[model samples]
Target: MNRMNWYVVYTKPKWEKKVAEKLNEIGIECYCPIITQIKQWSDRKKKVEIPLFNSYVFVKLPDMDRNSVFQVSGVVRYLFWLGKAAIVRNEEITAIKENLSNTNISDVCILPYKKGDKIKLETGVFSSQDAVVQEVTNTHYILVLESLGCLLKIKYKKDTL
Candidate 1:
């Protein structure tokens, strides 16, 4: 029997949920993490569920079934790492589930920076200041202001790093 593994599929813009649904309908297991948020407009506020990872969906399948997944509409390709299809470990998926389950959607956005990434403070009193990422948490990033010899932690909603 072919062993199953989790792999990330890159989808068309705004198609993460569609791809997952179609894959599931075809009997392929898939996971697309979504969070519910209140979206406000000038006229009204509405609750919307959005994919946590935009343009990406996870599919659990054996290597032999890769072509079947690719045949699905809206699936662009597999996410490749080092010339091979990137395989997501089971533990990583479990950790993601646990983290999201415990986190409030309004309190956190995705953390894209890793330790040692140089980023500029895009907004706030320290706007435009350059800092190094010292650590990352579920809801905040701990940054080190090298010149000032101080550490700062901030929560952000935009990809303004």
Candidate 2:
């Protein structure tokens, strides 16, 4: 295993749980971060469980062979570099634990924002640049500027990015 208890597997968009379940059914360990999302319908609304990051799922395998894991159903690929499998950091799992255990998952938190406003890039590559808000409705905001001319989306939190 060699410090590779956790590895990343790129999966079909919105198929995170299916892959995790498939892997688990065959005795392979896996973890898919589940988050709560409220779905609205004309007739009814409900809170549905969803994966936090789309197209990403985690697996625990005894080896770092990329092909072995990639062959699994719904798996597009494994995170790798220079033809070698990359290990997922332990902290990533820890962060997920905190989010699930410490926060109120039923209530989806919204970041205060709206479309078409002047914004300042506080961090990342475009930091210190003035940007125009293209879309802001919840926890994420999309920014744009002619100088960069590319969409810059960011997640917001008052105390942390």
Candidate 3:
């Protein structure tokens, strides 16, 4: 018998929660990591919960039950890596849950950068300054500004720095 394993599923846009719920209702174990954030409008602010990884949910099931998961509404397909369903290790799922529940992860979005990439500061007091990426982290980037002869490390949202 095939043992149960965690697999990643892709859902329709904005359907991560829906797909996970439907899968659970049918007895399939599923996880959809959600993050709470404070959303502000012109007048008032409210707390909102959104999927941490947009359009993705994790399902735990035997390999033989893959078809049943696909039949759920809002589930587009399994996330494929190298032509097969992408398997997520149990440790990864646990880490994701722990990270979301235990961390104060504010409105931080990770931006991809390489060690030698030239990045321009687009916000803050350093706006318009050009720097070379020294190191990249999940929450911030270490940049070296050639003109200023100093290194700057800061947490930034995507496209803002």
Using lDDT as the measure, the top candidate is 1
* Residue 136 lDDT, candidate 1, scale 0-100: 67
Score candidate 3 by lDDT. 0.70
Clash totals in order:
0, 0, 0
Question: How far out, in Å, is residue 12 in model 2?
Answer: 1.4
The lDDT ranking, best first, is 1, 3, 2
lDDT of candidates 1 onward, in order: 0.72, 0.62, 0.70
lDDT of model 2, residue 102: 41
Residue-wise lDDT of candidate 1 within 1-161, one digit each (tens)? Answer: 89999888889999999899999999999999787778999999999999877788889999988888977899999887667888877755664565457533234344343447787767734455566877766556565533222344445444433
Q: By TM-score, is 2 or 3 better? A: 3
Error of 1 at 157 (Å): 14
Quote the positional error of residue 131 for candidate 3 in Å: 26
TM-score for each predicted model, relative to the true structure: 0.69, 0.58, 0.68
Candidate with top TM-score is 1
Q: Which 10 successive residues of model 1 have the least lDDT summed?
A: 145-154
lDDT for predicted candidate 2 compared with the true structure: 0.62
Candidate 2, 111: how far from true, in Å?
Answer: 12
TM-score of 3: 0.68
Q: How do the candidates rank by TM-score, highest first? A: 1, 3, 2
**Model 3: per-residue Cα lDDT over 19-90, one tens digit each:** 888898999999987877789999999998888666878899999889888779898888876677888777
